[model samples]
Target: MTGWLGNRVITQIGILVHDIEQVSGAYAEFFGVDKPPIAETDSPDMAKTRYRGQETAARAKLAFFDMGPLQLELIQPDSEPSTWREYLDRHGEGPHHIAFVIEGMEEKVMLLEGRGFPLQQRGEYEGGRYAYMDTLKDLKVIIELLENDKR
Candidate 1:
């Protein structure tokens, strides 16, 4: 917990998959839970997605499973350039990132960047924003920061 990012808890673990429907079904069977619904990422107007510092129309199909303390996320990226697509292309279907629900996203991003993990992708969702940090070299996995807007 006393690390660079300062947070100790991971709220979600993301996995990259080529076939979201198949994987979601498999997950549901394996976990003995109902198959979660598949959904797509927001449009560029709403997501405001950016990858490697440039704006992009990155979109992905997503399914979420609520575990006890951590959620499992399945991501199937479109052809557009994005952290999810890039990782899927390079590494194949597997673990992508561990996410931390946080406050002061910009500050945490700066802190991680200062420690040499550059920001790779960022986007906005319905109620919050997310940033993917390129921490693979150092930590062997990307780090995702999620900040939900306060009501």
Candidate 2:
């Protein structure tokens, strides 16, 4: 898999949280680690899709921290009825998915889909693409493919 995706590998573990500040603080306090920097993003397509048949905006707050070789991403969505919000509503707050940094992401996603792994979500961010695969059948977990980029 790493060969097919170049040299990229599992570089991050993402956990969705309902309250960014509270969850981030709890992790910091429990692990005695410094808080990471937070980044905010808005996508017009996401907003339109989320508010389909209505009018609204898609806004999210994200924070990333380096934990040794892996990064931890905390996400909080301000938009209503979004993927993040929906996940939180269904599952509460905890480890949501594990992200694998990969190259040729589109090809990989296509291959996976052909092999019966349909994508749960896909979007572009910071010059890279991300696709989530529903791995519930095999691992009871979700897998995320992330293209390498500064974001």
Candidate 3:
């Protein structure tokens, strides 16, 4: 399929929660798997995080579960101005975004921006980068783009 994104395959689903440990524990029980470790996001220097078009020190505690063809991500944001925090504040705990593993993340983001869905938040991890697009008003949910560095 073809769209604004470089890739069309959805690789993950993200959920926002107030207490990750509690929610992740429940998911672990339901899946009959060990609870994934909760980890903090990269610092602003390392991640180069941006929120609302400006540099910000926003981060979240995250846990991930690989559920067959898709990964389930649970997020508990700090008191920072991150996308996670913003969504949780306005919408409460629930599905936050669906993610696509993509290539040419910057180019894809540019294309989306040209179409009016501007980038809301972005950050870099160890081997990949992620961007949250402001698509909720149009798509009913935010779209997250994940681009792994080519090895």
Q: Which candidate, 2 or 3, would have the higher lDDT against the true structure?
A: 3
* Full candidate order by TM-score, most accurate first: 1, 3, 2
Clashing pairs in 2: none
When sorted by lDDT, best at the front, the candidate numbers are 1, 3, 2
Question: Which consecutive 10 residues in model 2 have the weakest lDDT in total?
Answer: 47-56
Candidate 3 residue runs with Cα over 4 Å from true position: none
Candidate number with greatest lDDT: 1
Q: What lDDT would candidate 2 get against the real structure? A: 0.72
Instruction: State the displacement of the C-alpha of residue 128, model 3, in Å, after optimal TM-score superposition.
Output: 1.7
lDDT of 1 by residue, 1-151 (tens): 4576567799999999999999999999999999999999999999999999999998999999999999999999999999998889989999999999888999999988988999999999999999999999989999999999999
**All-Cα superposition RMSD per candidate:** 0.9, 3.9, 0.9
Full-model lDDT, candidate 3: 0.93
Model 1: lDDT equals 0.95
Candidate 2 lDDT, 1-151, residue by residue in tens: 5554465567788788878888888888887988766777547564233232334355678888788999888988774655566677888887778888777877887787787767776666756767777665875667888886664
